[model samples]
Target: MEEKTYKIMSGSGIMNVIMGISAIALGAIAGVMLIYSGVKLLSNRQGITF
Candidate 1:
């Protein structure tokens, strides 16, 4: 029973690490996209028609 519990715990830990890394990567991608859009908007400020 203890061995099974240890295995489960280790698996969970690995999953947590993977999830954390993926979240950070996703956040970075979103940040880059937002920055790019902001820069584009600033450059085209006079072309906006709304």
Candidate 2:
């Protein structure tokens, strides 16, 4: 039996890594924005008057 191994240093592989990193960064940014907006909305809310 023979075993084969492959390396992932090719151009497409590197591009895939970059794309994955970008997706993660974008998701983080979106989450931060959502939290920030929620906080802002809560802070600016006026309570109901009786």
Candidate 3:
């Protein structure tokens, strides 16, 4: 009984860790893309005439 409980707990712990890592990685990628898009917009604005 105790062995089964330990296995289940370990599996859950590993899943939690994996989820945390993916979340952080995805968030970082999203931030970089946002910054890149903003820079692109500003760079293109200089070429526009009023």
Candidate 4:
């Protein structure tokens, strides 16, 4: 019984690490996209002249 419990815990720990890494990767991608869009908007030089 003890051996089974240890195996389960080890498996869960690995899964948690994988999930954390994936979440960080996704967040970094989203942050980069946001910054790119913001810079594009800021650099637009066309102004409406009426």
- Maximum-lDDT candidate: 1
Q: Using lDDT as the measure, what is the rank order of every candidate, best first? A: 1, 3, 4, 2
Q: Which candidate would rank higher by TM-score, 2 or 4?
A: 4
Q: What stretches of model 1 exceed 4 Å from their correct place?
A: none
Best model per TM-score? 1
lDDT of 3 by residue, 1-50 (tens): 99999999999999999999999999999999999999998989978788
Weakest 10 consecutive residues, lDDT, candidate 1?
41-50
- Clash pairs of candidate 4? none
Query: Candidate 2: worst 10 consecutive residues by lDDT?
Result: 1-10
Ranking by TM-score: 1, 3, 4, 2
**How high is the lDDT of residue 10 in model 1?**
100
Cα lDDT tens digits for candidate 2, 1-50 = 12222343466688999999999999999999999999987987786344
What is the lDDT, from 0 to 100, of the residue 48 in candidate 3? 71
Model 2 C-alpha lDDT versus the unseen true structure: 0.81
Q: Which pairs, if any, clash in model 1?
A: none
> Model 4 scores what on Cα lDDT?
0.92
Model 4 spans with C-alpha error above 4 angstroms: 45-50
lDDT of each: 0.99, 0.81, 0.97, 0.92
lDDT for residue 7 in candidate 2, whole number 0-100 = 45
